[model samples]
Target: MRTRATVAAVSGALALSALAVPAAQADDSAASYPDVAKVREATSVRAEGEPYALNVSFSNVKIAKAVKVGTTGRVSTAVTYTLTHGTDVNIKAADFVTDAFIYRGSDLRPDHRLFGDKPAKCTATSATTADCKGTIEVYPAAHELLNTDAGTWRAAAEATAFNGQDPAGETFDISKVGYKTQANRGTTLVQRASKLTVDASPEPVKKGKPITVTGKLSRANWDRGTYNGYVEQPVKLQFRKKDGDTYTTLKTVKTNATGNLKTTVTATEDGYFRFTFAGTTTTPAATPAGDYVDVR
Candidate 1:
């Protein structure tokens, strides 16, 4: 008979003291840090059992096309895999753990730590086969990735089989035979971020008089966690009246160095003026809030 189970992971707790202590009253010595032994145990990766014995393999891996980040929000990618063990072995789904990670640069290390790995949910299809899926999360604001996380990234999948069943003994050995690791050298891109802003001079303007509209275009600079001008790029100037539900494109203006914008239009009615940017392969599109102008 077959049984289903979900392994639960132990949750770690963090403690903080609310009471303020003077610098002189506190222990300033290096001994104040956590014990070296506990730190090593928590940070170090455990050794794996021999893979040849487990005969573990992966197939049918699917990684998302791209990941995007901007001021508005962030994007995550889905990764799936098929896990198979040795012919005679019958491994339960709950006895295995899987993970999917996104890495940057040629070293293929998670050095940037730009993205976080998520645990996989695996279901046993047969005695030797299981299907697993997981996601990699990208955060622009929290991680300060901005445009920096853009470009090609490496995706990897890894799984491990414990010696015993779920909620079992804690002393089992972790080694090669207990683990399987595989990766796809194929690349996925993270698009750059785009931004736009608009304003109209003279809050109240005379009817039929010339009103100047101005704005700027910028994109995230990954290295700096800030935005910089996107020069020589054409942007659309749009307008929508108070009662109108849709905005109509009035004209197109190209950005100059430093991503500055300037244009003029005759005041016809009270409405909003805004700027829109058409994104490129490296950058994602963005539209800023409208600047209201009152006409007398």
Candidate 2:
């Protein structure tokens, strides 16, 4: 199994440097702050004979910026498996599916759902002959909650044969993949900005203010393509009045492939406001309070 560079080594250096500087100096520094640490690490399980060993590695894991409200950034990992026995083995792609399950605590039960799908296969030999290696990319759904009260999370990978064929089964446990301590420095701002402004007509909205929220999602180091994945699905803008207990759904909109949206909403109050954007494949991103101002 091939091992790529670990995220901790890369981000850790940045974090240490950020911590070494004076508080005031650090505040002025342009270095990007890491919202989540690469705490949970896992190595792929290697199996012998019938049961193949699969190894997975993750990279570029970090926290989403404040502008990334309702959305969470993720790390990409590659899963590799080696088949020892040359004996003809017919394995369906789906059978080798790999899933990522997150837990709030050390206990595995009541695991919080993250992401799941079939592993991507890269075969060097013929489709049905000899040895094969499969790979897949897994992203955490609730990446925004990584370093919060939700506790540390551990990831486990399970692979099975096409059918129930159990010629020989072996499971190798890995430290990097299992359970580990997590750090929560609170929400790390990936993008620097003041507020999100919404333009609407009709002076003050008495009953409801019809407005549009327009903005472009951008990242300094990350490319636009990576950010677009979060906004590809249908999204809803959730709103609430100042000092309100619960939020109400204002309007729904879909982000184009470029991660841009001009969502429409009906303002309900004349006070501080926030916007919660929800999507299917990605976690929801929210605007900071005071981002919206209402005059009613």
Candidate 3:
């Protein structure tokens, strides 16, 4: 499914306009941002319903290294890129607007997308070259991000020039507007926040006695702003000797109905213990600090 670009001025360097959709469809991905085949019964440009390609290209596009989105609030990642355009194209024009965003799926026709609440601002290094920067904000629950939607997402951008024409004008012609889009400029991970905790009881135990290790595995709940238990997930119980540099997996334990992990190990040497979760498609791996124990 594709989306249409609409006019609603927001904040930021690209603070010109935003894509407006029906209020009732705020969380509907296909109805939110611009991607493809957007036009209505209006002008000739609207006739083709395809945005005419403008003379512009995006290069050296870089998205934030970590996109760890949580529940409750918006997660914004900074985006920086280079934009090259023909000399005839006036990027400094009052109505010239361009920005980059991220989408999930295999194509530019996005079914789900994350857009900056503000527009990107650009600085011209030359008449034909410019540096651009912006942000893409993700509201996990609002955009309907699923556990399957994590891992990697494609990067893309769009530009629009009103060309002295009012998009909201009664006589407006989308055909007269200049537009361009670049897809697959690069890719970035869209990972959910995960948390793991560990605790070993009877820290000072006899060398040959039993020690109990326990932990909890949890991940971000985008709808509730909480790190809820990740039930029935497998978590590794790892131990590292105080004199050793590496941690060895002592055993693998599955989380209980409430994401709690517990297991027994025989005390042999003084060491630290921790829990590790390999993670799922929607969540990133978690390895928290270890809890130290003493063996008498």
Best by TM-score: 3
Answer with 1 or 3, whichever has the higher TM-score: 3
Write one digit per residue (lDDT tens) for candidate 1, span 122-203. Answer: 6778877888776666655554453545677676655544444221235423332244555563456677667788889788
lDDT of each: 0.59, 0.33, 0.70
Q: Can you tell me which runs of candidate 3 are displaced by over 4 Å?
A: 1-51, 106-108, 141-144, 223-226, 231-234, 242-246, 256-258
lDDT of candidate 1 at residue 57, scale 0 to 100 = 73
Count of clashing pairs, candidate 1: 8
Q: List model 2 lDDT by residue over 1-296, tens digit each.
A: 11122332433212211221123222332211111111121211122222223332222223223223223344433333333222343333222222222323333332232222223233334443323232222232433233232223333333233232211224322221221222221222323111222333444555565655665442221222233323354445556666777666666666567656676556666543334443212232444443445556
**How well does candidate 2 match the true structure in TM-score terms?**
0.31
Range of the 10 consecutive residues with the lowest summed lDDT in candidate 3: 4-13
TM-score on alpha carbons, each prediction: 0.61, 0.31, 0.76
Alpha carbon deviation, residue 251, candidate 3 (Å): 3.4
